[model samples]
Target: MNAKKHSTLDHALDNYSTADFLLSDHFVNHQLEPTPETALLWETWLAGNPPNRHEWDRAVYLLESIRLGLSHYAGQVISEEAIEALLARIRETNRQYSVPVRSIGRVRWMAAAVVLVLSGLLAYWWHGRHDSESYYAERMAGLQSKYTERVNRSRAVETIVLSDSSVVRLAPGSRISFNPSWDGASRVVYLSGEADFEVTRDIRKPFLVYANEVVTRVLGTQFTVRAFDAEGKVLVNVKSGQVSVSKDDVPEKGNVQDASGLLLLPNQQAVFSRRSEEFSKSIVSEPRVIGVENEMPSFEYDAVPVTRVIGDLEKAYGISILYNREQLKNCELSASLKTETFEEKLRVICTTINADYQKLDGQVVIHGGECR
Candidate 1:
């Protein structure tokens, strides 16, 4: 023991309350007996001893060196009950803290009591710290898992980077679910509605996307999928690389033609209609950008009757239109009305036909408004 340890031991003796003595004896025996907070306090005091600072630093260095040298001892297994029983024997011997019984056997008995109490406290503190660390680790793991589990409402457009650094752009009113551990036999994702995927190449594990009863399997492909339950259609358009689309029940080997299956190249589209049980492939010259671009024609005014134009207006603007029986036949006009509101377009049409227009509950009416 050096000067710092000697001074520390002297201080320990001066502060020899039962708790201090018990703690000091345990430390001297190389046993842990302090709570984490208490252990921190002991370390703090050791560092603050200015007179013995050099010796304290050297002692701490040696302790670390000894710990590394004793790494093999970590494999030893000991039970808490055995340690407790030993501590009980020590407590019984020193319970009264009476006079010195000067017999060889009596000395040995006292020494055994000291070792037991010291070792028991050390073991208890070590186990407590270890248990506390493990508990925090488990809690952190649970929180990480919760981060990936989510339910989204509304139209949400999001971009996500996968474990392999691939990017996917999810469309509005779409659902996408993936695991945090996005690795294994296959990198899989569940998709509902629409999304565009730009996959990184990992030939070892193919990327799979599941939508409804359809499964798209590919390796390093760029593609867009528009799957809708209400529309009863799944559109798979590949912009680059190869993709394989097969019905859930389709086997690996059969007389299934390319029409029943599709291996799409760049700028190709595969549409599967559930109602028709049909799969169609086409060389898409100009792919319709789903959700981003409107697919319907802007203006249709060639030989269409007035009734047909009004019907188109109602469906496009989500409104109702009523016209007088005689006005309906006389209201025919050749006009283009895209990018115009229900009332604005109706006003134009009413003016052209010399018919008065009225608005009612998001509806356009032309009077003399008859039953028809």
Candidate 2:
């Protein structure tokens, strides 16, 4: 690819969020439903470099609100024709959906807060291990020698230093099976699930990943591998560097050339089908978004308005937001969610709004008539 294109791709990949991946998945599944107006808004918002946090939160809030509203109003009973018309008017004017609210007591709030904080720390520690190349390389080699032990739910997270210094964070629920006595020119591992890899550069010892019939070769790079057993499809998302992906024959004919793979650059993805023995590549953005750079403000609130707090909850958790009283939007809420459950989080928000939460048909609804 040209330098300009490569640069643009890198920027998009590094700053990718869960929403972008969802959007791509829509296209991949052939379920794209974006209207021209929505597309234009997305383009305009994404064109800006590192968009403002408040505006970014608002955009996510609006999109989710609309999505939820559509789902709710699709099949609901209304009193009179005028009430139906009024509902339509409200929907058109709001252009957003109200997220369902679930109640949580003080105890639940405390427990959830603890989990969230600890999860963040664990994620950070995993990244630190990936930064040390030598550590992970040795660990990787040791694990390869011990492959094929056939242990159920045998989970291990290792940060190995490759021959060169680079880091890779392997997520949980990943397993590898290989020969203990195997020492070939190429370093290889058989993947059964998902794992993130940060490889060190050594033109001599190329890193090879085997997922079912597909093989991914990389000299040095950071990427993720997802081999779904149910669907029998494999995916590789490259964060940096380059990789060559291909398919091979079944184990019965050891090491037979099945089909040639495709070369992928940074911010690109490759998908392979075991049955069809076909691989396709396309551009993909990164997976994480909020709090990525530490430059954006954290989800901290101190007596903040209820509407703004609800907006934050929707962005952080990727869920629907709802409210019955418009006056509650101005109610003040002071709470932290560094650790909390969905129920607890809602209670905190509800407490400030002085409202009650109810669940109706798997959806939460806030029904108090007064606020403040």
Candidate 3:
């Protein structure tokens, strides 16, 4: 809020992804488990800058997709050529996620590498027709508007079940107002403060949350959105599935519906930058597996290639493992561990393999000597 805080934030964001966002430690932390401090930091960043939200969302989806795709090879021995081939496959998959031939006719990517159309462009496109603001706002206007608004002024989280059975855990001091339009056209809610949503999947109707200018849209997923007015920021953290985020601006040119805005995957967070009117993506401060039911392992590797060990670790925790395969390809490890934490697992692995792993700019990065 102060000039100093804004200046510090700008510097951090400016240097944000000085390397690839996917490769950064921020991504790694979010991929693993983000601490409350980390989540708040990102929330502050996103809620401050609104314009950059879309980019953050798309990157989250892409990064998570790539990580999942790579996890399939956990049991296999990865050679240099095999790794290259896998990278090629990743590229191909990315192309698939991108816009294909613009089915809407007027909505085409401005650049080949641009993952999602910016909300500015989308605002322009949607301002003409299919204006979600006018459509939903008009629908909610006058006595004809039928909506339910809930405000939580108490000290405990309020769990509210919507008409469609979608559940929202409204944080204390937060408010959420929604229309029982499930049988109608769109399921939209206006939110303030922070709340976690366990949204029921509805193919026919998409769940949309509007807080200030930031919009978080999803079909069915578990995620948290923080958009407190006093904070001057909007933030979305996806626990499962993908969530779309956009600013409230309706530009005069491009179609808003045509723009993807931000597409967020599990463990990723998007910060809306009000200072610069841009959205930035970061990993949650502490990211845990979406479902706690997944069996956490007591890993034991015997004379296995370092790659295999790392691969198994990645799979076990559902997080990305970045390492210098050239340095570790020939190395082998023999370790028996039980009741160790995720970090402890890595520490033992690294010790046995003569490697060092750490959170590098929010990613798990490892480097070490050859075992041979």
Candidate 4:
């Protein structure tokens, strides 16, 4: 097959007109998948002082722009047929504008024009296939009437301090909108993308973060909310204090009370699926100590029963660890676990006592055989 392609390329170079090579499969294949043989052949041809060298350069530029435009904007592979169609469109456009296709000075302008045209078409198709407006745009539009918006367009994280002293670290490409003045009822902020929030304590006005389809309500806490518009699920991970995550459409009857939602404590996470509109609770990937550093629990257990060790871990991390007392009563461990992580401590104890642990509904459950 490579030999046949090489033959075809040789024939095109020898007999075909300068611009006619643009339509040859050899040129398209070379542009798409360049091999050493094809590169050498093209270099040799260019070295022969072809009169249409400018046209060749222009063609390469145009083809590269088309490939890049389609890949970046449409996220699709460029087919040979699509390239042919695009070439035809460029010719038609050049003819429509009464410009020569091989104009050296206009090559860059033409390539840019083609890219813009392709970008516009991709945008139109994307909007037609999906929602007319992006999830972020739709949510922002809904709040435009009553809120002030801030967008983080930079590559680095942006810090936004609200009037209530709540600090929001907005991720790049994310945006948030909030009422300029709180009405003493509730402080609400709508988010699109990910953000880490350190909300100030306010018993009177609860802080709420509305992201995508889920609403996260907290009085005063530090947490991270990951709710990108294009993602299939929304995530709320509590770092300190507590938060209630619920569907945005669900009405809250009383103060900070969600009709149906998951209450996430420190080191807990809630994953809300957009398709099913359901939530699944789980422990965060890395659970940290909940309280102040000075009050950190001593994990150095010396000949202590497994139950007492588990109790200390549960209290330190503010997570429940369930195990059968009768089964693990005889299990004893003597290890200095102060340096181990929450999971490492659990693993060390469980492994010593022939037990296995699993996380279910944001809590750790242990399954172990009777210790002799």
Candidate 5:
């Protein structure tokens, strides 16, 4: 590759850090077209970056594995374009025909593809043959050699305190493994199930949790992660502080602009669907008062204009409540809601005002006609 071409390819590869992007139709069609130029581009790019070679190799392994599996099924080797088209067709078939694809055991690189091919015409016979938990166990086997592993086999939640005084509450059937020494630039833990974490404040070393295909990063925060191996979704719910959630496969190369993910604040949650390779942000089911207990504001209202009432609620919970100020200008609410939950308060207020509220994109939006 020429210098200009190499530089362009390098810039593009830096952004294509996630395996999902690499496996997408755009990447397959343009970069893996079996042309000599494409081959040279990848060869030069891979040879230039020794540290990221493993990422390239892993993507290649997944692509070839999918190709070989499809070839074995069709009795002929398929081209990259053909593979992309077939995968798209399979996804559409799944949506149209409701043909469920089971997850594979060893590698979840291209989970949908691997499972669809291995199932062979959507057979239910392979349902219980391989366990997804084994895949997680095998993936963490290498780290287990150097990390401390904690499993909560009991019915109750288990409490674990890390070396940095970070607390982790592992739910039943959950497991977490981490380095005890805390010598790295970041505090990392591998999780396979559900856990609530209260990380100690450390601006220098951000805390990272690897849960299935999703990764949750925080400087210091309280959050819950539910990522069971057999489940199709990974959830990160922030209770306090901020979190950056993204696909675990995305490589961090010291460029903030190159990163693609969701930034979650208190009471915000992110859901990652393994099948769609998508992330969705929303408000948590239950939102609590945001500030310190002693400085908490009262939720009492005395025939106050509905706008002021909503403003108080927004300040108390640190959530956005949307409503037209002009329409609700004549509305008044009188209630002592200090004991009520977040949703309960909204329900009570909406009921009194003959209004209804809907959650949209992590905010509560009220819709109602102007009161007389």
Candidate 6:
């Protein structure tokens, strides 16, 4: 945390992003258990800081919608009648106003609430439930989805191809599940442990990976998601193309502003801290060439400037390398990097140029004193 963030308690209430507030431990704890002290803190905070009121309301509404959706998703039938009634009344209002129902799904309307009362956080009986409630509620009631599961428990990687020709490299002790017969808007897969996905191109049907509490969305991209039980965190790293990863609690289409987690380009990674419900993003520590086993690129350079070497690497790995060009403009390097990994190449180049490299949000930033 920076000094600005660390001093937020005595500073402005709305200094943080909406996501920071939504995913904070304090907010979630207060939402889940608003004891007298918690209630006092939030109520007093909300009353004093008028600017934060809107964000507070949004956070609450988002949490409620997510709780409801997850309840339905996990086959928990707690307040179906009340929630449905609420949806019905909202739909009726939309009809009166002549509002077109969004073709997206029920999750959209879930953000609507005429009344601003916080829905009680109630636990459910997960005794014998075995299906995604919201996903199957409308479809299964009308016979629209067919699903299957694939698990790899051996000490070797397993390749599983989906009906859409999307390829999955399922790591040992991992499971990748989806409908065997696919006829849906998107190719949805529930993953546990780690798996590398090479999705087939179908912009009409984007691919979605649900791992732990984070949802990774991509269209015809290659990426990797890791959410093993022992890790207690979700990690998403994009190999090529773009990928959007957001927490399940936050609205997928968060308002008109797109205020959520992040959209990662190649070599970017997002890590979700389960305990704090916070997201931390950075460049991948070691990005490799995106290709099959036999198609890795070769790297060779002879007395080349650092710029040329890094440029070749950037093209090979599909990741951005940022640096002060003038500082290292005169630096030269001569090395064969074909056998080295992405990080190895970076280290070699940095050492040769007497420079240092750090992975920033989604790019590698080079730092060095002026080369003599």
Higher-ranked by lDDT: 4 or 6 = 4
CA RMSD of each candidate after superposition? 30.2, 20.9, 18.1, 17.3, 16.2, 16.0
lDDT of 5 at 330: 92
Off by over 4 Å in 2: 1-168, 178-182, 250-258, 287-372
Q: Write the per-residue lDDT of candidate 1 for residues 130-177, one digit (tens) a residue.
A: 432332223224443422522235577778887788888888766666
Better of 2 and 3 by TM-score: 3
Instruction: Give lDDT: candidate 1, residue 225.
Output: 83
lDDT of 5 by residue, 323-342 (tens): 88898889988889989988
Provide the overall lDDT of each model, using Cα atoms, as 2-decimal numbers: 0.53, 0.50, 0.60, 0.72, 0.69, 0.64
Per residue, candidate 6 scores C-alpha lDDT tens digits across 136-228 of 222234432366778898999999988899999999988766877666666777777899999998877778787767788887888999976
Query: How well does each candidate superpose onto the true structure, as a TM-score?
Result: 0.35, 0.37, 0.55, 0.63, 0.63, 0.55
Q: Per-residue alpha-carbon lDDT of model 2 for 1-372, expressed as tens digits?
A: 211222112334335433332222221122124554544344333433333334333333333333323333344533346444643543332222111111224433343344334334433433344322322233345452455532225356655433345454444555555443345665665665677888777776667777655677887887888863333357888776678787744432233234466877665678775434568664453322222345433557787777776676555433345675466755776777656655567767766666766532223466673554
Question: lDDT of candidate 1 vs native?
Answer: 0.53
Candidate 1 pairs with clashing backbones: 32-122
TM match of model 5 to true structure: 0.63
- Model 5, residue 123: distance off in Å is 15
Candidate 4 residue lDDT tens string, 93-156: 4334433323334553554465556645644554455443456566655553667889999999
Model 3 lDDT tens row, 134-195: 42343335323466778898999999999889999999988777767554556777776799
